[model samples]
Target: MKIDDNFYMKLAIDEAWKFQLLTYPNPAVGCVVVKAGKLLAIEAHKEAGLSHAEVNALKTAFLTQEPNSLLKVLEKSSEIHDFLIKNHNGFFEDCEIYTTLEPCNHHGKTPSCAKLLSILKPKRLIIGLIDTNKIASGGIKTLESENIDVTTKVLEKECENLLLPFKSWQNKTSIFFKMAQTLNGSIDGQISSQRAKLYVHTLRDKIDLLMIGGNSVRVDKPILDTRYVKGREPDVFIYSKNKAFSQAIPLFKVPNRKVIISDDLFKLLDYKFVMVEGVYTLLDILKDKLDFVVLIISPKIRNGVNSVNELNIDFEILHENYLGDEKIVFLKRRA
Candidate 1:
């Protein structure tokens, strides 16, 4: 079956969607290689610290090739750069490489992927979305300068969705925090309501970690699993000065979960990768030199209880509504 340019580009988008599974706080990207009129390889960025989409796709394409074969073919071998160059062989010689987003040109944490592509001598490059970061934005220009044919603006909307997080991160210099709440605006009520439990499960699937105070764990007894969402589970982060949670807590059963006990309780728990979650706990973490993002899930209030205030963050009541007997109020942090 002959694959048209549109078909290959769509395949690239599908492959890139896999990055959403593992690229928390990072933009998801997918790549596809069509060599000698055949779909040679396809893959997405598996996780934050793993090899990128380009590297994974190339590795899959060059599986039976020689050691450093990519370096020999492309004349470069700096991890990410070499992966693109080596994989460009006969496949890309007179063909196109479709990527969900523009190739990266910056050298942050690695060399420029664009520079490597130029050396590999691919006949044409098709981009779904452009890079928003200034440092990495001109990949097309870099390729064009080397006389490589480059086409873009295909599947622009899909590309935009994949690159949205990266653009947001580049602009804010922080991870984009997303939270979903009930129509009444509560995550969970005073008691562990079913609706709230389902919301917690949703949050667990979206974030890299599930963070809460020791009090919440003791009160809610959450399992912190993503079984309800059918996606990867986030690591559990408990904000506690000591081991206030019982050994029977469901978080303990999860392999990646960590109990962030302070100096007062560090000796109490023998778990690895511990960090403080609250202001008091953060002080202890700074003292121990540990770092992590704190994710707080504030559910709706049933009566007059304020979850934001408990965290010491000042928020203004935006609106209020009722769901059955439960009272839901929209609160925005006071700037």
Candidate 2:
């Protein structure tokens, strides 16, 4: 009973921050499965081309030790590595997965979670971040050529701050604005915290494209949803040049929503996880089409004036945490 491994790799980096920024262009990653130390399953990668938190925590530890398997082939499925190589039964011999990244060794749309963890032969394999992409890099050298026992920078800086927007969308589509404020830097009066607006409605339910700031859709007629999370809603983008809107703006009567009023932030490169909220003149007009910024603050001290403390902007925070009274942080931009 000795294994700790940073308490299950910090619970697989806190279950990959509940799909941080909502797995755009995929890269949220998470997984857990354990053995003597017990856990069994944890899971993450809940979207974008599907299964990959080590095959949904190795298909929930092979249907939790095959409890009569066939749970609808792991429900909302993608033919997971041929039903986990036809239902992994070797009860993962002394199991111990952890993952946050680095298990994909190619063969798209499912299959090759490092070649199905070298055919379910787990004994050890920690990882946090490594797939430097060549279509999911070597997958920890094919699980050390099936000798299994792998491990790479566990919890590596919270899995590289949850793959900073899938490594800023690996060459293109990035954005990320976010904002919140207060403690004497008023980003509006609501100063946040229904758990920081339910973590911005769970990053607007793993975003697809959000945008907003053209006087925040004509003075906050906002309903840019994900209604505190349950998923599906992001396809808004009101960038603005006002084509006369106001059918009483509940994000324009959300019904199979797709809003897009545009003044074109180059139509946000077609899309892949954009966020962008508002103020500071929409972050100095998209501030070179940002890539990250979150901020937040909120503790209380409302001396308002649309604060980011009268911006000058440079960014570089990288990470900081908190949720209740708020303080978050996250920035980026310094090179």
Give lDDT per model, in order.
0.57, 0.77
User: How much lDDT does candidate 2 score?
Assistant: 0.77
How far out, in Å, is residue 57 in model 1?
2.2
Check candidate 1 and list the clashing pairs.
Answer: 16-30, 70-86, 186-300, 187-299, 187-300
| Model 2 lowest lDDT segment of ten | 71-80
Best model number under TM-score: 1
For residues 1-335, what per-residue lDDT tens digits would candidate 1 score against the true structure?
A: 64577788778776665444246545678888766666777777766656556656665665534455644344222564655554545544764678888887877555666876788767778888887767767888899999998888888876775565455444432222223233333444444445544544554565554445677678767666777666656565565667666889887787655545433433423322222223333333333332222233344344433233223444444333332343333333445
The lDDT leader among the candidates is 2
Clashes of each: 5, 1
lDDT of 2 by residue, 227-255 (tens): 76666788887777877787797887877
Worst lDDT window (10 residues) for model 1? 287-296
Off by over 4 Å in 1: 1-3, 64-91, 173-219, 223-335
Q: Model 2 residue 205 lDDT?
A: 72
Off by over 4 Å in 2: 1-6, 9-11, 14-19, 30-95, 100-106, 109-111, 124-177, 188-210, 216-236, 239-272, 279-295, 298-302, 305-335
